[model samples]
Target chain A: MPDPTSSPTLTVDSAAPNPAPNPAPNEASNETLGRFNFLAVIGRIILAFFQQVGRLSMFTASAVSHCVRPPFFPRQLLGQMVEIGYYSLPVVGLTTIFSGMVLALQSYTGFARFSAEGAVATVVVISITRELGPVLAGLMVAGRVGAAMAAEVGTMRVTEQIDALTTLSTNPMKYLVVPRLVAACLMLPCLVLVGDVIGVYGGYLIGVNKLDFNAASYIQNTWDYLETLDVVSGLVKAAVFGFLIALMGCYMGYNSRGGAQGVGVSVRNAVVSASILILISNYMITELFFAQ
Target chain B: MSASPPKIALSGVKKRFGRKVVLDGIDLEVAPRESVVIIGGSGTGKSVTLKCVLGLLKPDAGSIKVDGEEVVGLGDRARERINTKFGMLFQSAALFDSLTVWENVAFGLIQGHKMARRKAREKAIEKLAQVGLGADVADLSPSELSGGMQKRVGLARAIADDPEIIFFDEPTTGLDPIMADVINDLIVKCVKEVGATALSITHDIASARKIGDRIAMLYHGKLIWVGPAATVLDSGNPYVDQFVHGRADGPIQMELRG
Candidate 1:
């Protein structure tokens, strides 16, 4: 089976211009290819990339501005909160739990060779809280919430419901986009916090039962080494990831054109963009918080 | 005193998507409480014209005036103010599936006008009744309704605010002939009862005759012929004749692409 996580990116990239543009027939006929045409194609690709970045940045700025503006929709925001946060908890929790368990087992085996098996609990707790919990939760939510937001909004766009909202004297940005952004930003941190606890507990389960470590000592070691900054940084990363996820989904959906195929492309784009941004920003945020 | 300005007017309007020009310079006017229908083949920019007037799509050039106020390039706040005076019934009814029939109808009142929910519900039921829908239909989701019923609910929502102007986009495009006539009749009744100026776009000649006071034919991005609805058959414009009589052979040729 195709990996569900990377499938969206594959579809979106297929829709985009071929990464290696096919050689033109006339150019292929010429043994010595003209350098200018190749440069022109490269230049066009670079320009298109920058153009898309500019558009997305503007959309993000507008959505963020609307999040702080008046005429807020508390009910809509709450509805999105439930959708993004409550509905995503199980998947995030399961992923983090397995990840923590596996990390503990791998670290225990490595540390056993060095006669340092006691470090397994500390390693699991630190990794889960500092990096894995937020990153995993972010990716999972991007798959679930981001894809759903894009599909729903994209369908609304194609069906003229967004235009209908405009004609009804409601700003589509404020009515649709802002609530999702606010909900994601506020809720992702909460999800990361919960996932962090569940993940540490998962490590504890493996350390105590599967690995012949004392339960109390494992718990004590986890608490002794995991610092407050670790959790705080992870939550911070979660917030940024949440914002980008919601922004990409809304931007792709709002600009969706054509019809059903357009909506499918948008759904794929939302998941792909959100996943890449989550990974990139995770590193940047970690550097910001921990780099010397 | 200067004569009151047309309820809505467009002059020298132009819109092009990429290289294809959908609307070339176009001019038209709808006097107060006048029902004007623009007839055109699919893809001839009838919807684009409505979108431009509704500020959903911005024209590339020229002026669009609503109640004598130039709306082109207006900011969101100004556009919102302009939209409050208008309502639209989309071709698909475009009801919010997330909201019930009553909530959809009361959306503008509650969200835009900030009316109390209880009062808005009462008014929504009243409007639904006006469209011949019973109170029981108010709480059901729009998805549960049949196409004709959805169109009725759409009409009810469009007139809920008693807007000064209402737009009906392809009001009968997908309906059976009988249902289309019913919708057309409701449109006429609602527009007349609300005393709202009406602007509609459709290819249905029977609907055009029933709902429009004046009919204009759009061909090749321009209003090729415009006159009273009764005189459409006698307009003497070949394009109008070809379209009205549904002739396969005409001066207007379809752009067939392989």
Candidate 2:
């Protein structure tokens, strides 16, 4: 009865305390008797889901608002760009290059059965740009950068460094959350662009050298078949995925509790949520751009 | 400051987390340029009382005033305006790890007051020196420093911009006796030098006696005893007596199976 693709936010922490916090929630587990009401459980789950969405919405709104506000830290923003975008290039490159090569081989074999080998270039170009490029790059960055943001900010939260930031007259949301969100949103599209090219080149390599196709012919077919909307749609997906990744990372990190264990959980949840949101949004954006 | 209004005042301040009532009804005051310390066991709401004043956590009931102005439930901009006059040394020093030592010290000045970086850096170094740290430690990360050195840096940051009010949350918690004494002396020196009103919360009686003009004892969400720091050892209350002496078998019982 539950659709996994419909939920972008993690519901693990959805049962937030209504007022302050009840540290003794474990007491419920002690009641082994007649406390298991199926309807109550369903209602609780539904309410928790709504609460999580509401919290995520509020957190995102504030982070976006802070992005446009003055007193922005140019140094922090630049540092995050280098961390999220520049440092991520090598990994993205490798992934896309391999993916393109695999696509060329797979499409060649499939199209060869029908004597449509010329269609290999078109299939590789469209698939890489419209789906694989942004999705794979987004997933990789989410694992690398999302987990890092969660661990770093979560540690700060537990250690009271965030509280210290407030006392020092700096807004932690502006300083900590805004820069990462802005950098990811700006950087993921660039990474996806690079990925699309490399993936197509990978396909080209297989088609030309390994599959006995003329290099010039392969390049022409690929260039002619690739449309602007295919690439733009993926780039657009990259931006949305980037924002979702950063938002989940920041939201989880800011709310992390306990200590090291809590931080570890936050990091895991951040990556999972970011990755799922990327897949789901990738589908939605594709529909928006290509659906008849 | 003119004996008309206390520098900081709390009347019937209360806070509760779930069923756990942390601060039932705290009523205390610190006069102009005075050092007042609250002593209590762990989880006795000493930090909560200080947090209420700092506007970190809002009390469920009653009023908190700084310089005769009510601050409870104030908006962010207004609260930040009042907080501009205050500095705090957290229990863990809580220095920014991303920054070098001097940058951490100058953070409030550069970010909050919008001071020029060069000027703020100069002032940071100066404050560090006043805390007995040499200029060589300026570029080193805070993680490179020992606990005592970190506490020193925390104190330096607290007094960096010459704030009007300072709060020390367990300033001497993790330090050796000599280092704790060193910090206490620095705190006294800084308070006198800046002419700032000081409010501190600590279980360390030595820290309390050394830095406090007056001391209050909080027990189970209420301040049961309040008096001059000189008479803390002989406060005539069993709870204060138990806490001050670190007696295990007194009115303050440890929550453990015997």
- Per-model TM-score, in order, reads 0.93, 0.92
Q: After superposition, how far is residue A17 of candidate 1 from its true place, in Å?
A: 30
For A1-292, candidate 2 gives per-residue lDDT tens digits of 5568645443544545443375466556546423666667888999999999999899988889888987688888899999999999999999999999998898888999999999999999999999999999999999999999999999999988998888887888889999999999999999999989999999988888899999999899989988899899999999999999999999999999999999999999999999999898888888888889
User: Candidate 2 deviates by what RMSD?
Assistant: 8.6
Q: Estimate, for each residue in B181-219, the C-alpha lDDT of model 1 and write its tens digit.
A: 999989999999999999999999999999999999998
> Model 2: share of native contacts present?
0.61
Clashing residue pairs in candidate 2 are: none
Report the Cα interface RMSD of each model, rounded to 1 decimal.
0.4, 0.9
Q: Write the per-residue lDDT of candidate 1 for residues A132-214, one digit (tens) a residue.
A: 99999999999999999999999999999999999999999999999999999999999999999999989988888899999
Lowest-sum lDDT 10-residue window in model 2 chain A: A11-20
Docking class of 1: high
What is residue A277's positional error in candidate 2, in angstroms?
1.2
- Highest lDDT among the candidates is held by which one? 1
Give the residue spans of candidate 2 off by over 4 A.
A1-32, A35-40, B256-258
Clashing pairs in 1: none
